[model samples]
Each structure stands twice: as structure tokens, then as C-alpha cells.
Target: MRSSSVLAIVVVLLVCLFKHGNSVPVEMETTTAMTTEFTATESSRKDIVFNSTEGEMEKPRYPHDGYCGHLEEACSDERRCCPDFECYHSEGRCIYLMQ
Candidate 1:
């Protein structure tokens, strides 16, 4: 019937409006900040490429395993690594991502 068709159209319009209305603006702001920080960190890493020792460039040390190791689950949970790049600094080392 025509009533059922009109009801369906109203439901579709309501769903579309609700979907577009529910997003939080703060999330977009945070995402923008994260992107900016990432770009800066990448540029800084270029300096490490030239300044660090050959061994450091070849295989940076990790906090857990001494050489090129990933952070333990506990450490990662605590956000122990660097804010810009996840650094592993256990054995006098500062491990950062290449890019």
C-alpha cells in the first residue's frame, strides 16, 4: 500500500540522517594531530640514518631482546615506547622505525 511505501521512505531518511549525525568531531581532531606527529617523526628519522653508527642503522637494539626485539605485551600496554616512534631502549639503545 501507499502508506507502507511512505513509511519505508521515512525510515530510510531517518537512518541516513542518524548515520551522518553520530560521528564525534574530537576523533577527527585527534586523527589530524596523529598524522602531523607522524610526518615530523619521519623527517627526524632521516637524521638518525646519517648520525647513528653502522650497527645502529643495520639493526637497532630492542628493549626486550637486546638487538632488534619487539616490546613485551606488558610494556606495550603501558605505552613505554616513544610517543612519536615506538622506541626500544633497554641496552643503551633507541630503536625507532625507519619510515
Candidate 2:
């Protein structure tokens, strides 16, 4: 009878250990969450420039060309484009200024 009781105790202890061994899944979940958050932060940063939206910092588009390397000069035309805004080369594409 005593041996049977000891066997029962050992079995209970083994069951507890098996249950605790599942902690690996919990740790993996935590690691995955942290990795996901880090990736999201990096993506968001990449899409931002000067703390402004990506659209605001977009490269200048030229009326004759696509992406203009002379965006600085293109931005100078106040009558055509908005002030303090950037320009990009849009080869042969006309710039539509909001009247």
C-alpha cells in the first residue's frame, strides 16, 4: 500500500512538471510580440521625414521630366506651385495647380 501511495505521488509530480514545461510557448509568444512591435516602429520611421508625412516630403516632379533634380528651382516658382512645397520631375506631365 505504501509503495502504491509513493507511486501516486510521483505520478502527480510528473504531471505538474509536464504542465510547467509548456512555458516555452508563453516565452515564444512574448518574443514574437516584441519583434512585431519593433518592425512596426521601424516601418513607421521609414515612412516619415522631418516628422512629417511621407507625402509632404515626396521628391519634386518636373513638368517636362519625371523626378526633377532641379527641384529647388522648380519650387521657386510661386505662380505655378505652392510656396514652401517641394517639386518632383514628372517628365512631360503637366502640373495641375489648384486655381
Candidate 3:
């Protein structure tokens, strides 16, 4: 009877361990998926563009102040910066100018 009890205890412990082990991998997968989604959102923010005619352009509130003087000017891939003059050219690094 004692041996049977010991065997049952061992089986229960084994089942609990197995379940815990499987749960860890599931949690890790969930975390990785969230990280990937956040990265994609951050990259898309950098590539945002606005129509010149919309007149909805606004200067970047952080990092560099004022409009970006040139395409080579310091710009954040996460924030929008207005063009110094007008947005006459095609799609580039320039943002729409504020009216």
C-alpha cells in the first residue's frame, strides 16, 4: 500500500511538471509575438507620408526642432518633421509643410 501511494505521488508530480514546462514555452511565444508587433509598428511610423494638399503636416515635437532644412537633415524615423519649404518633389524623406 505504501509503495502504491509513493507511485501515485510520483505520477502526480510528473504531471504537474509536464504541465508547467509546456506553459513556459507558450508564454515565451506570446512575448516574442508582442515584441515583433511593436517593432513593425515602430518601423511603419518612420515611413509615414502626408499629402501636400491636405495641409495636415506638423513639425516634430521631439528630437530636432523646426523644419528639416534638407533631406539629409537629422530626422526621426518615429516622428514627422515638416519640410522647410514646400513638398514639390515626389516621395522622399521630406514631410509636408505646415500651412
lDDT of each: 0.50, 0.49, 0.53
RMSD (Cα, Å) of candidate 2? 12.5
How do all the candidates rank in terms of lDDT, highest first? 3, 1, 2
lDDT leader: 3
Candidate 3 — worst ten consecutive residues by lDDT sum? 27-36
Pitting candidate 1 against candidate 2, the one with the higher lDDT is 1
Q: Which prediction has more favorable TM-score, 2 or 3?
A: 3
Per-model clash counts, in order, read 0, 17, 1
In model 3, what are the clashing residue pairs, if there are any? Answer: 46-77
lDDT of 3: 0.53
Q: Which parts of model 1 have CA positions greater than 4 angstroms off? A: 24-99
Off by over 4 Å in 3: 26-99
Error of 2 at 48 (Å): 50
The worst-scoring run of ten residues by lDDT in candidate 1 lies at 69-78
Local distance difference test, candidate 1: 0.50
lDDT of 3 by residue, 1-89 (tens): 99999999999999999999988854343343443344546634653445488777553333454334344343444433443533334
lDDT of 2 at 51: 24
Best by TM-score: 3
Candidate order (TM-score):
3, 2, 1
Tens-digit lDDT track of model 1 for 1-99: 999999999999999998888864544433434333445476446433432555445333345543332343223333344334454545433355567
Higher-ranked by lDDT: 1 or 3: 3
